[model samples]
Target: MQLKQALASAVERLDAADVGSPRMNAEVLLLFVIGADRAYLYAHPERELTSEEAARYEEVLAQRATGMPSQYITGHQEFWGLDFVVSPAVLIPRPETEHLVEAVLELARGVQRPKLVDVGTGSGCIALALAHELPDAEVYAVDLSAEALEIARANAARLQLDKRVRFLQCNVLDPVWEKTPDVIPSEDFSPSRGTCCSEFRDFDFVVSNPPYVAFSEADKVQKSVREFEPTMAVFAGLHGIDVIVPLVEQAHLALKPGGWLALEMGYSMREEVVNLLSPTMWEDIRVVPDLQGIPRVVAARKQ
Candidate 1:
């Protein structure tokens, strides 16, 4: 079968299965199966696929039809103009999260050798991007799930940023947690063992794209996300503040005076998330909306 015919068939199947962006999904999966770019696909539409290639295309199309995210099938996603490795173990990095990164960069402006931490760094997109942009900064990424950390570490190595960031397995900023040993530690990295919030403090910025979806709102989430993505990386709790509450508390404790905390939240979470940042402890609180005008990032400066 020709590339065009296979793509048409895949698109029809995906559309029938009620997948969003069926054509785009079909094209991505086809490109993955054939190991070709969109340019090649267009330039060689009439080219015939071998039996193995056709079978592989059918396999991936079936996966997409079942609502498995294309990023998982491709094992890659682009964030902040950088390619990242992703999997079912981690939440797929979204474009909206880039706003969170931008908000942190704005907060870090003019701060020399700023120390930063990324909570719930599923794919390490935020931490690595910050490291890439701020070559002199100290960056750390922490996640509750060891499986997710594996993928994040892999992405760091893939981006040739293995030495630029530290990965730790911890929930929020738990007082006692050990750093993942695979990642090379910086010369100034202290403790080299389990540590407390005392050692985690004095950051110039604490940023995250944490799980903000509440369990009650599970029905509102897309089927693919609810079904295929890691549950810990999706739902926070009954009120969706289970993760955010502690994250806010730890960020407040971990940040130096005047340090900033930036977070990416759900469309409905601006008010609730903002409320978590107390007026007595946090100031200059602001909500940053995405291109669609949804409140995507909430940032606050420590008082």
Candidate 2:
């Protein structure tokens, strides 16, 4: 079939399946199948689809109809102007997380070779992006799931940042000092570093987009996210602060004196997050809004 005809049919199918933004999704899927950009797709609407290309398009459309994210179907996502490989193992990079990266880069400008760590570095998006922009810094990433780390490692290599960013299989909730003494020490560890059940330690800056969606809010997420993405990367406890609270308390101990901790929270949890951290432990605790003007990132400095 002609490319235009196939594109029209795909859009109709997606619409009937209740996929939001059907036309745009169809265009993007077509671009992926044909290995062409939007402009190319438009310019060559009459171009005939080979049998293999048609088959691939059909397969992708089928997945899309089931609410699988387009990025996962395409096996790639673009963030901060760079492309990263994505899979079901990791959370797809979101535009809102760009604010976290920007805030970190802005703060790192004056520091030399700043030691930075990304907690819950799903797909190593934030860590790799920071390392790519700040080549002088020592960037480290940690995630609890090994499968997620595999995708993250592949993404780092694809971006040629393997040497700059390091990925470790570790849980941020556990006290890291006992397991990784070389990085964090027991004596230097602060009492406020969460429950101190896990060991790990000092970084110049700590940033994360930890799981903040409450279990009750799961059904409210877009079908593309709730149905296909990993749930471990999405929902937290009843208040959605189960992870964030521990991270905030521990991040204070993990960061160097005056170092910054940047966190991405649910749009409505800014005030609660600010109130959770003690003023004595973190100075200049404030929330920054995302591009949509919703309060999204909360940043503070270790005193």
Candidate that would win on TM-score: 1
TM-score of 2: 0.91
Candidate 2 lDDT (Cα, whole model)? Answer: 0.84
- What TM-score quantifies how close candidate 1 is to the native fold? 0.93
**In angstroms, how far off is 150's CA in candidate 1?**
0.3
lDDT of 1 at 86: 93
Model 1, global lDDT: 0.87
Clash pairs (backbone) in predicted model 2:
174-198, 175-197, 175-198, 175-199, 176-198, 176-199, 176-200, 177-199, 177-200
Which residue pairs come into collision in candidate 1?
A: none
Candidate 2 lDDT by residue in tens digits, 1-303: 999999999999999999989999999999999998988878888999999999999999999999888888888898999998899999999989999999999888899989888999998899999999998998878777778888988888899998787666666635444454324322223566443334245678999999999988877888778878898898888778888887887787778799999989998997899998788788988788987899988889899
Query: Which candidate should be chosen as best, given lDDT against the real structure?
Result: 1
Q: Give candidate 2's root-mean-square deviation (CA, Å).
A: 4.9
